[model samples]
Target chain A: MIEVENIEDQNGLRPDGRRALELRQIRVKMGVFGQADGSAYIEQGNTKILVTVYGPHQPRGSTGRSTSNITKGIVNCQYSMAVFSLSSGERKRKPRGDRKSQERSLQLKHAMEAIIHLEIYPRSQIDIYVEALQVDGSEYCASVNAATLALIDAGIPIKNYAIGCTVTLINNPSLEDEDNALGKGVLDANYVEECTPGVTLSVVALPNNDSTSKDGLIVVAQGAGQRLHLSQFESLKARVLYGCQDIRTILDYAVREYLTEQSLPSLFHVALN
Target chain B: MEEYPPIIVRLAINRIDLNLIKNENVQPRIYTPGEEISSQPDFLRGHGTYVDDENTLRASVAGVLEKVNKLISIRPLKARYQGEIGDVIVGRITEVQQKRWKVDTNSKLDSVLLLSSVNLPGGELRRRSAEDEQTMRRYLQEGDLICAEVQSTFVDGSLSLHTRVLKYGKLSQGIMLKVSPALIKRKKTHFHNLESGASLILGNNGYIWIGANKQDSDRSEGGFTQDLSRIPQINREVCARLRNCILILAQCNIQLTDTSVTYAYEESMKYKINELLEPEIMIDVSLLTHQRLIQQ
Candidate 1:
């Protein structure tokens, strides 16, 4: 097991023979459901995410955690795992009420709230549920990205877009931990590279803003080890910004295709019928 | 920046990865927005849209425009949940466990039907026997459309259902339509079956059972279109009719409710009230269910 660590040496060649910044093939399907306002399923690298959107309807449960602006909508999020959605033999179907899912749900809610224009539909709710059927690495990132697409599919408005990605530093023994987090970074680490013992940073970014909003710069800027220097943190943040930009580009393409396919329902009947 | 080989090239060269290559990557304008996408036929959704300086790229549909520099796309999905706290969804029994029947809501997850929640025959609310108490498979077999309620949601995302209401039991007659689970919008309550003909309830979890109700009237009188005697049998011709009804509703995007039966589902004789009916409606009546709807 230890030998599998650092499968991608300093040569920057991934175990799968890809580059540091390269993403695995993404297969996206839009409007897979006939009943959802907007829904999407995306397979990124080894991770798979299915996002469904509900609402812009009268709110349920207690209100006022959000305000009375009738123009925007309240976005409710549920991040879950299917009972049969285990990826590898080593992985168990994540327990439904687990803390990770709960925490991730709140984190996603906070991050998405910043992007979506919630003031438009007061007393109403827009539910965006993301189910990770297969988790490899960057599962959080996959959920955020998929939810964004589903939100777009649902036609929800956003002030600006939010995208998430993760970076893992392989920890060069010779080089100090301080120096590595700076630029010797791995962009979008996969399961194998991610498992390498080192500092991992999860970031959610708004690509187009040039990051004008203070908190808007990174929706999430959490690092998994004790601490890192501010400058090194800045480097990691910068890398995420680039990932966000790259993701924005991909998302843009996907939305265009979805819109194009949606205008004609005939094609669906022809194919599925 | 760390230098690396072109991963896209490696992917492009790998015949195996080609299977995973998105349709949009293979073609463009054909995959452009407005539902007439000629390429990447299965492109799904991307992100933002791009317009040239001239503002030519327009999103023709009513969805969010996802563009990448100059690329554009859109796909629509439903967003409303109309069911109330205690609304009943008449679903087909799809799976059966020891004590529960799982029904598909036409939503993302299957709704549940607790055996205890159901009112057994002879008015006994208590468990009858291990064999008598519950063979379960005998009481509510699979493929039955039983009416149930949203008692609660399971931690794993499944809906808990109950059959406490007298009216919301197993279904009978009329053909069945099986569409994507999400189309069945949960409503405040759908209580009436307007067709006037005997209808039964069967849950989709395959637990609820249904029989025909067309017997007492048209079948006995021979005034209606379909022969009554043959209606009891679930044979090739009957199967065809059932399949036809399902296919029609699924194809036309029609919503069916208790009071919402139209010509395609049945004939004018079956409906006691005269109303303007739409083109694509049909009735689904099964045995064990038809008579139950009538006496009530």
Candidate 2:
């Protein structure tokens, strides 16, 4: 077993050599597939995800047609982990169609629902398919980030970026004894740290236009591992919010870069004219 | 003996240099979702814009903005095909219903192709009969590709397609490649038979078809008869080459039209059909094609 003490060395560097607050390098590409209405590929740290957005078209089949809302658009999400995503030596029989996959799919829909402007595409259904090619840690967070880019690629109207981030509470409570309440909480926790006995909080938030908006509207929050104290929740949530903000800024830059590439020669034409 | 060489792979970066674009005085304005557009009183909200609580017009998608009189709209970089009357499209039949066939045109909804709109197999003015209704699948069965024009659009944004013209009917023995709908240039006609032996149909919905040049197609039968006869090796080679050329051009985000495609095909003649898929060759051919377009 990889112990938390072993993962976090005496120098305060995690096994990945990233500081507690530091994020993994992010790389994103939009419109990775021509067939999908909108598609994106994103890599954060060692985790990689590909997301494709289809529809806002008429719902498919009788079930899709029957379940679609008349006044608001339906956001359907499927989160599937690839067979090789497991870091364990043993392989799983099924990549999806399991209880855990279903739960993750539902959680993804909730995160998407909070961001998408559902009322604008009334009677239509938008399907978001996320495939996790590799899972290091924060797979859920990476899925949210990749889906946001895919929605942007598809030109679907979104209210704001639904950025997700995970924070793990360090076992070293003595750092909290020094007066810095959040000293022991690590931002953007990885797979090994996530597996540690400490509490982990995964939050999906929409950062407000106001940069100082500390606790932006939380869309989804899932806590796992050891039981967290009520007093620790505030500090852990704040750390996650900060992580979310950093991610949103990176994703926003990516979206702008993609848009610039898309409108290129038109800019040239305008300049020449 | 080996007929074709194995494929080679190389890594290349596809980054757009914004600094180079910045040298130009006119940098195209781009909008992302939730970005404020305007608060002016006279401007009306358009398809890609909505008024927020403070009466500020905000963009809903990322793209360039267009203004005409009081209407302000942001056109997304890419979206499902939004149909307009008289627009040409190529689609595959998904389902054959009672009086219509559901055609997937890469649109927001499956477009409808009514039996009444298409020319009957025997003649143009044939009356509807029980036999024709029962044999609807035979006329244009599921998975059959067809070229048609947009007759109308429903309020929900679905399209009604018609194949009344001789050129608009079943397509056979062709390769179809889909690209972003925004890349297709709106032209007077979508069908073209290049000086090269391949005939091309650049669907407005971005479904392009390239096929062997079929002269003297049976028009009296209304394109229902299949020409399953084996095309010569040379014609097949020409069709494959044209397909590769079109794919490369589309990949580079070039506007697809008859002139542009012809230029790309001509520029790509120096390389084998498979060689054109290489990153360096694709860029070289498209760059030459781009230069020729500008010169024209």
Candidate 3:
């Protein structure tokens, strides 16, 4: 693992030399398939994810818990992976639903609910299955973007964005003299950065869609780490906010590009294949 | 008829990067005397598109619609059909029965390619004297590529084929891969062997067989070379690797087949310049895209 022992005062850049809140490149595409009502493939830096939206139709073979809501639509999510869709040298044989996938599914559902209109069509189900073809980092963020495009492809309406971002606390308090704010404010933690034992937080922010709505709701913010103070938390939140705004711009452009059928669609690493 | 001005919907590219550009690529098709384009279209039209109600023209709203006579109908997994006795179709091997294999030809049930239906190398038309059976296995195995003629369609759409001809026999050289039956039957299927160091065979049944020599590479000799420098001693493993490479190309959905694999180049052809093979831009026709629910 690569280690960054010291924080920098020069421009406050992280180890990657990125600004306090600089996100990786985001490439997206909508309606990339023939079968799905709406489908999207997104690549945030090296991480590639494909999302497909299926049905507000009746449930298929009652197995999972079904919502009693009669008028709103129910969203069914299955976050799986292709046999070889992992960064590890050896491919993952199992589909999603391992401890990691299950956790992701829940977090994904939490983030998704923030945007998808579950109240529109009652007694119906919307299935969003995301395949993480490659994981570099920010899987949750990638899934959120993919799901949004899939939803839009499915023509689903949503209230603001249900955007997600991963913020890694560069300040690994565990290492003495590891530079105060070593993991300081950074946006869009890639796989290399996320693996370090620093505190990592996944924040699903309902951004200031109206600009003035700065009193935004942090829908699903969960972090895992050692004892951490509140100031670090505040800075992290701010970084996550910046990341969300950045992602929203990419996604908004993607949706618009899809509608206008833009020639020379914006590039993506996953869909071009 | 000069009665009505035709409506053409064509889409143009503003930015080749977006891949939102649509082209009016057309090819010619063969039509049965009375077979009209099925009145029902079980597919979605991209923006600026419409399938006429009368099953005639699937016109483009803004781009050009090239008319080809060949119209393909999607068949259910089990629906079987008798081959037209001469029509070249793609299929997959479903079962290898005694001296025969049941091939799924994108129809109900499967089609049969009997051992006797294939031609023996060295041009002999004799019945299988036990030695022939051993030789046939060496030439055409359980999952080998042999272009056979549909001899007949039996009780349940089971088709019998015959390939005792010069054009049909064991395939050698080159490589092959398996994909969704939908891809094989795509109207503009690429089969012309392009840039071939070998030859390939695409069995309507799922088996893809390839050979090394131009004879092994099948008919698209131009794709291969005459500048052999010398008769390069082709090994069996190299032949297999070439097959694997072609398979990878298919998995990538690059579409290189024994029939439609022609390399096209044009001054305006942006295929190379645009980095078109990137996975992000290619629209894989998936089962999920049909979800019409606009998320609210």
Instruction: Return the candidate ranking by TM-score, descending.
Output: 2, 1, 3
**Model 3 docking category:** incorrect
Model 2 ranges off by over 4 Å: A4-20, A56-72, A87-90, A120-124, A171-178, A181-184, A211-216, A219-225, A229-232, A264-273, B11-26, B40-42, B122-126, B214-218
What candidate 1 gets wrong by more than 4 Å, as runs, is: A4-10, A60-72, A83-88, A91-94, A175-183, A209-215, A219-223, A265-273, B1-296
TM-score of 2: 0.89
In model 1, state the lDDT of residue A231: 61
Top DockQ model: 2
**B107-132 per-residue lDDT for model 1 (tens digits):** 33456777777766555455555664
User: For residues B28-140, what per-residue lDDT tens digits would candidate 3 score against the true structure?
Assistant: 12111112334456544332223433454232211112222434331111111224545455444544556776654533335677777765444455566667554544544
**10 residues in a row with least lDDT, candidate 2 chain A:** A264-273
Top-scoring candidate (TM-score): 2
All candidates: TM-score: 0.50, 0.89, 0.46
The structural similarity of chain B in model 3 to the true chain B, as TM-score, is: 0.44
DockQ of each: 0.08, 0.43, 0.02
Between prediction 1 and prediction 2, which has the larger TM-score?
Answer: 2
In model 3, the runs with Cα more than 4 Å from the true position are A3-12, A63-67, A173-183, A212-223, A262-273, B1-296
Writing each residue's lDDT as its tens digit, candidate 3 over A1-273 gives: 354453333445665666757788888877677456568899998889999987654444572245556555567788987677667657786887688788778777766665655654455567889998888878877888788767756555454556778887755545455334445656787776776656677777766433413443453443545556776777677767877877876776665445434211111211232
Q: What is the lDDT of residue A124 in candidate 1?
A: 58
- CAPRI band of model 1? incorrect
